[model samples]
Target: MRCLVRERNKTRIGVTALATLAVVASGTAVVTAPEAAASFPRGEWNETAYRGQVEVIPAKDDRSDRRVLRGKVFVDRDRDSVSDPGERGLRGVMVSNGRDVVTTDARGYYELPAYDNMTVFVTQPAGYQVPVDEYNIAQFYYHHLPQGSPELRYGGIAPTGPLPEAVNFPLVESRATHTKDQNCVIAGDLQTYDKTEVEYARKGAINDLAQRHDYTGCGVLFVGDIVGDDLSLYPDVKDLTKSLNGPVRFLPGNHDLDYDARTPEHSFDTFRAQLAPAYYSYDVGRVHVVALNTVRYPCTPDVDNPDGKRPGCDDPENKPTYNGRLDERQLEWLRKDLAKVPRNKLVVIASHIGLVNYADEGSPVHQVDQVREVYDLLKGRKAVAVSGHSHSIENMKTGDLAKGWSDLFGLKGLPFPHITAGAISGDWYSGQMTEDGYPIAVGRDGGRPGVVTLEIEGNRFRERYTVTGQSDRFQTQLGLNTPTYRDWYEARQEWNANPEGPAPELGDPHVVSRDDLAGTTWLTTNFWMGSTGSRVKVSIDGGPARWATRTQQMRGEDQNVGPEWSDPHAVAQQLVHGGSVADRSMHLWRFALPEDLAVGTHRAEVTAIDSYGRRFTDALTFEVVEQR
Candidate 1:
C-alpha cells in the first residue's frame, strides 16, 4: 500500500501566521513552545495581539445624551437608495439600534435612540426590498460615527457631525421575498488578492450569478474572506456584486481585517465604511439571518514563548494576531437579536470562520473559540450555520464530532447543521486553466469550486451546491482507488509540483486487476455537498444497490483522516495538474469491490441522496481484469 505524505505546514491555506503574545492580568508572560506552536498553524488567525488589561468601553447611551433619531421606511418606486417625495412610507416595518427592536407606526415613521458608533437599520420587511448601492449591497442601515474613528489606517467611518432630524430608509415592493419558498445564495471565500484574480472571479462565479435570477430577495451573503489582505479590493468586490441578481451582504473574514488597527472596536472599521455592518441580522421569509463577527483580533495571551518573536500584549498595537472567537459585545447583540425572533423561526447564523469544519477538523484554533457558548444561546432554536474561510465545502449534520472539538471545546456532537460554503476562488485560484478562462481551483477536500444555495420553504431548508458553470445535478465525482492509484498519487504530487523528468502517468482509472482487488481496491465518490442524513448507494452490473459507507461518521469518533480517506477523483486531478492536495474529506464515500467477481467489464450506477431527500444519480464503467 502506498501512503500519501503531506507537509503539515503547507496543508493549511488562507490562515495567517502567529505574530506575538501578550501579558495576562496577573503579570505573567504568555508564550507558545516552538514544537507545540507548529500545531497552532497559521493563516486562520493572523494579526491577533494580547494585552495585560482590556478596557471595556461601555456603549454610549443616546437617551442619556438627549438624542433621538426619527426615520420613515418608505417604498422606493425607483429602487434607488435615496428617498424621494413620490415614494410612500412602509408601515409596520421593523427597525433597530443594535439593542431595541421596534415596529413602524401607521405612518411608517419610527424613532430610535441613536448613539455614537451605533448602526440604525431597518429590518427588510417581507415583500418589500431594500435599495442597493452600486455594488448591489443592501444599504438598509445608516452608521452614526459622530467623531469618526480614532487614528486608523484606511480611514474609518467619516465624521457625521450632528444627528440629522431623520434617517429615512427606502424600500421597494418585491414578490420575490414575500413567499415562504425563497433561495438564499451563500458564497464562501472570494479571496481575490489581486486584480488579476478579481478578473478570474468575474469570469467564474460572479459570471454565473449574473446569469441566474433565482436568489433575488434573500440575496447573496458572502461569508467572509471577501478579499485576501488587500482591503483596496473591496471596491472591486463591490463592483463584482453588481453582477449578482440580489442585494448583496457581506460578513468580515480575517483577511478583511484592518491589520493596523490597535483595538477590537476598530478592527473592522474600514470594512463597515465600505460594506455592510460588521455583524447584523435580517429577515427573509421564515429565516432570520444573523451575521456574526467571529474573527477576534489580538487573541488571548499565549504563555509559552518569551523571545518576543511572537506578537504579544506588551506591544499589541504593533503586533496583532487573529483567532476565531465571538466577543462579549457581539454575543450580547446576538441575544438581543434572537429575542426579537420568534421561537419557531429558522435562525441562520453566518460568519467567516466556521463554527466547526472538516478541513481543520481537529484544530480548535480554526473553529469558533466560543462554540459551546454560542450553541447554548441557540438552545431549543432550529438553527443552521454557514461560513467560509476554510476554503473547503463541509456539510456537518447534527451530532458530528471531531477529537479536537471534544478535547478542547468539550463538544461531543453538533447540535445543528453547520455548512462551510465552498470558496468561489477555490484553492486560492490555483491549478491549470479551463476553457472558461478560470483555474480548476478544486478544494482541499476535492470538492469543486461552487456556491451554495439554500432553498427554503417556511422554516425548512434544503441546500444545493451549483458548481461554477455547471448544472445543479453535477453533485459527485467517481473514481477507482488501488495500489497503483495511491503510488501514482504520491509520485505525481512531487513530480507535478517540481518537474524532475518525464511526468508520471496514472493507469486507466477504469481498469482494475485481480491483484489490485487482492491488494485493496475500492470505488470512491466525492459528493461535494453531501451532509449528515445524506446517503450513497451503488449498484454493480445493474444489480441490487448496496450502500456505500461514509468515511467520516461524525458520530463523536476521532476524525477518520489522512490519505486513506482521500478522494480518489480529486487526488488524481490535483496531484498531476498541481493544486491543493485532496487528502481527507468529510463527504467522501467508498465501496469495496467484490473480490470474487467474474473478470469482465462492469458498470456501476451510483445514487446520492441529500438530507432533503433529493436524489442525484451517476454511472461509471470499469473493467475487472485477471492480470496487468
Candidate 2:
C-alpha cells in the first residue's frame, strides 16, 4: 500500500508510510520512506532493545523444583511489558506448553505440565493484542530451557537459569481485532539467506507491510522460512520487521532448522529462541488460527514418506534430511487446540509445508503426511488451510483434485480450501533486478512475489493477494504466448544449457507477426490466487467479453507443464534474466486470438472475477505485424 515515486535523480522515494491515520489535504499519508540499501548500518543492530523483551521473573536457583508452569494473561493498561497492580487479569485466554491447550481460570491464572525445553505462551484473545517488540515481533512466549540449546550454530536459546515465578503475558485492548471483519495477512518465505537478501526483503515485502495499517489486530503470520539457511542473519531479519505495525509471528520451515542438530527435537531450538514456538495457536475476532510445525527435519527412515523424495535421515554419516509431516505431539496438540475453539468460529490452519499444493502435489516430502488426519479433525467446521515452502501460489478449493495428491496420499479430493501463500524470496530472489530494488523472482508456478490476506467476516472469509510493491487490485499478469515466443522459450532453454551463441530473445512480446497468428497465439492470464469458480474474460478492442479456459483445471489431472502451459510474461524474465522457469501453473488461463485480424495495433482488456466476486481489470496493447 506504499506509493513509490521515482525522483528526478533516479532514486526511488516512497511517498507514504500509511501507518499513521493522519493524511494530508489530498488524503495522502506522506512520510519519509526507508533509507536506501547502502544506507543500512553494518555490524550488530539491536535498535529495538529500547522496547524491551518478554516479561519473566526467573528463580535465583539454576533450576526449579516446580513440576508445573504457571502464567497469567493480564491486561497491561500502562502499556508496559510487565503486569502491574490493579491491571485486571483477562479470563478464559488460551495458554499452551506446545502440547496441551488450556484456558485461564476466572482469575486469568493457568498452569500446564511443565517440562524441560518447553515454551509457555498465552494466546491473545479477541479484543486483546499481544505486545510486540520494537521489531514488531510478538512477545507472548517464554522458553523454559534450563540448560539452553545444545551449542547450536546460531547459539540457539540461552540457558534459562530456572523457571520463572510467573511467565505473565500482557495484553492491551484493541478495537481493530475486536470486530467481526478482520484482514489477516499470511506471508510465505521471507527466507532471506543473507544481509543483502535482507535488504531486498526490506525494500520489497517489508516496505509493503510497513505502509499497511489494515492488519493491526489479526496481525501478520510469516508462515515459514523466515530466513534461509543462515541463522546468524536472524538479527538483521528481525530488523526488517521493525517496519511492521502488527504482531509478527513465525512458524519454522526446513530452512530455519538447525542442520547440525542430531535430533529432530533440537532442530528448531535456535528458531524457538529467536523467533517463536515450533507450533502455536491464537485467536483474532471469531477466527482461530492454528499455526503448525509441519516440517520434520532429520526425518527418520522409519517414518513412512509415501511418494516422497527425502533420501536419508537415519544415517549419521550424512546430513539429516527433512520431510513434510507433523510430530506426534504437535498432531495431538492440534486436536486438543481445535476442540476448545468454538464450532462457529472460522479456523485457519497455517503451516510451513502445505497440507496439499499444486507445486508439490505429488511429493509427500513437500505436502503434509497427516493431511487426511488434520482434515478429519477440522471436519464439519468452517476451516481453511494455508502454507508456504513451495514458493508457488495455489488456491485450491474443497473437492479440487490433483493427480499427485491422489497418488501420493491416496486422496481423491481436498476437503477444505488449501492456499500456498507464494513467497517473498520468489525463486530464491533470482532473475533480473528491478528499479524497485529486488529481483523479478517469478515463482516456478508463474505467480509473482506477493502476500495473501484473508478478509474474514463472521465465520466466512475471502482471500486476496497483494503483489509486492503493488496494490491490492494488482492481481493479474497478461502476456502473449505466441508460437514465436514459445519457440524462443525452447531455444533459450537450450542455449542456457550450452553457451555457444547468445540467448534467444523474446522480442516485442506484445507484438506477434502474421506467422505467429497463423501458427497459434494464446493470451495468457496469470491470476495469482484464481480458483475453481474464478473467471477470466477478455474483450478485444472494446468488443464483447469472451471467456478464457484455465490451462489446468485442478480436476484429477497431472500438472500441465512445459512451454505450452507456461506464462510467457514470466518466462521471458526467467529464461533471459535468471531464476526458476515459469513452466507450469494451475492458475493460468489461455484464450486464443483470431488469426484473420488485419495487420495493425490492437488493444485488449481483461476482466478477472475471483470466486469471491471481486473483479480486477488489466489491459495489453499489441501490434499485429506482417513479419517480425
Candidate 3:
C-alpha cells in the first residue's frame, strides 16, 4: 500500500473563531423579544484582531447588558479556509446553538447573543449535501471550546451560558428524505473515489436498488466508506442513497477521515455533522441498531520522525490508538443507551469494520482489535454485528464469548454471527467489465452488488441479499472441480507470462469428469446461512477435507510507510504455507488417490448441510490412468 502524501497546494479551508456564553440565574429563564430584536447585532459580525482572556462568565445581579450577545462569524464559501471577500458574509441563513435560533442579515450573515455549551448546527435544507473533506467526512459545526462540557449521560449540550454572536451556518442543496418506516436495508461500502467510480457505484448497485421496493422492515443502513476521498462526491452519494425506497443511515470507515483535521477531537467532526451520530443507538420494531465509529483516530502528535517525513500518514502518532475499543466516554454513553433497550430486543451493532477477522485473512485496520470486549458486552443477549471495509463476505458464528480466545479477537467464538457486508464497489476498482460496462466488482462470495434486507417480526429477524434484479439462484454461484480441470489450472499461471499472448487453453470441466463434483470445491463458498443450525463440513472417504484458503488477504498494509498492524488471518496463512497439494497437513486441502486399490476409476462426493439440516450433495468419478 502507498503512503498518503500531502499535496503542494495544501491550504486551510474553513476556520471560524466563535465565543459563546450562557449566563442565567438558578430556576430562571432568558428570552429575546421578537420585535425589540431590531437593535441587536446583524449582518456578518467580526471581532477584528480580538485575542485572549475569553471566558463564559455568569452575569452579576445588575439588571443590565441584556440587549444582545456579541460574537463573530467566518464564512468558508469556497470551503478552503482562507476567508476571501466573495466567500464572506453569506446572508439570510438561520443559525442555532441547539435551543435558540436566529436568521442572518442582508449581508449573508447575522449575530446572536451567546449561550453556554450550545451545539451550533444548521438544519441542512433540501437539495444539497454538506461539504466534506477528501475522505468524504462532513465539514460542519464548531468545536466546543474550553474542552469538556458538563457531560450528559446520553450526550447533548449542557445549559451553561448565552449563545454566541454571528453563529453562522452553511447550507447546500440536499436531496434528503424524511421517511418513517419499519422495513430496513443494510448496505456496505460505497467507496467511490472519483466521478467514474461514483458512476460505477450508481450503475452497479444504486441502479439496482433503485428498482427495489421490498425493504424488509425499516429504511437502509449504509455502513461506511461513503466515498474513498473527494468529499465533493457526497452530494451525488446522497442522491444515490435517496434513490433507495427507504431512509438511509451511515457509519464511518478508516478511509472516511479528515486528513486535514488539526486535532483528534475534530477528527470525526465532519462525519458527525453530516451523518448525525458516531456511536448512537436507535430503535425499530423489536430491534435496536447501534452504529459505532470503531476507527479511534490517534490524537497524539508524531514523535518517531522529528524530520516530519511522515507528516500526515497514520504513523505511530496518527495510527488509530484503540482498535475496536469504545473510548471510555463512548463506552459510558453506550451503557446508558443499552439501558434504555430491553434485554430481549434483537440488537444489531453496525460498524464500518468487522468485529473479528474479515474474510478469514484479515486487514488490520478494517477489523476491530478489541472484538472480544464488544462481544462480551453483548454476550447472552441476541445480537449480530454487520460490517463493511473488507469488501468481501465472511459470515462468522462461533457460539459465545466464554470460549476465552475469540476466533478474531481474544474472546471465544461468538454466540451470534458477525457479517462483513460485501462492498458495493468491490475489489477497489479492478477486474473484468460486465455487459453494463461496469467491472464485475462483486466478490467471488455469494454476495452481489445490491443490498441486504432484514425482515423484522418482533424479536426475530430474517436476512436476505437482493442481488440487483436477479433471483436468489442467480445471486449465488457454485464452482466445478475435475481432474482435467486441475491439469488446466496448473498451466494457467505460467502461460500468461510468455511474450506471445497465446496461452494454453483450459478444458471444459463438464467434458473432463462427467462427474457432478467437478466445480464443487476449487475455491470457497458463501453459504449465506440464516441465524440457525447451518453447518458446512466435508470429508473425503471419512478423512478430513479442509476448505480452500483465499489467495489474497483482501486488504494490504502500508508497511512501506509505518509500523505493521497485525492481522490474524495473514498470520494464519503464513504459518501454513508450502506443502504438497495432497498433504492433509496443508490448511488448504488437495486430494491425491490412495495407490493400493485405485487402479481403474474412483468416485468422491461432498455434502453440504444447511441450518435446517437440509443436505445437498455433489459427486465426481474419474479414471486413475495407469502409469506406463
Question: Which candidate number would show the highest TM-score if scored against the true structure?
Answer: 2
Candidate 2 segments whose C-alpha is farther than 4 A from its true place: 1-54, 60-65, 304-310, 314-317
Q: How many residue pairs clash in each candidate?
A: 32, 0, 50
- The C-alpha TM-scores of every prediction are 0.83, 0.89, 0.56
- lDDT at 248 for candidate 2? 82
Instruction: Write candidate 2's Cα lDDT for 386-490 as tens digits.
Output: 999999999999999999988877888888898899999988999888799998799998888989999899879999988999988899999999999988988
Highest lDDT: give the candidate number.
Answer: 2
lDDT of 1 by residue, 16-81 (tens): 321232322111122212222333323211111010111111123333354777767877554323
- RMSD of candidate 1 to the truth, in angstroms, is 14.5
**Candidate 3 lDDT by residue in tens digits, 184-215:** 67788888888898888777778876666554
Q: Evaluate residue 344 in candidate 3 and report its C-alpha lDDT on the 0 to 100 scale.
A: 91
Ranking by lDDT: 2, 1, 3
RMSD of each: 14.5, 9.9, 15.5
lDDT, candidates in the order shown: 0.75, 0.80, 0.46
lDDT of 3 at 40: 31
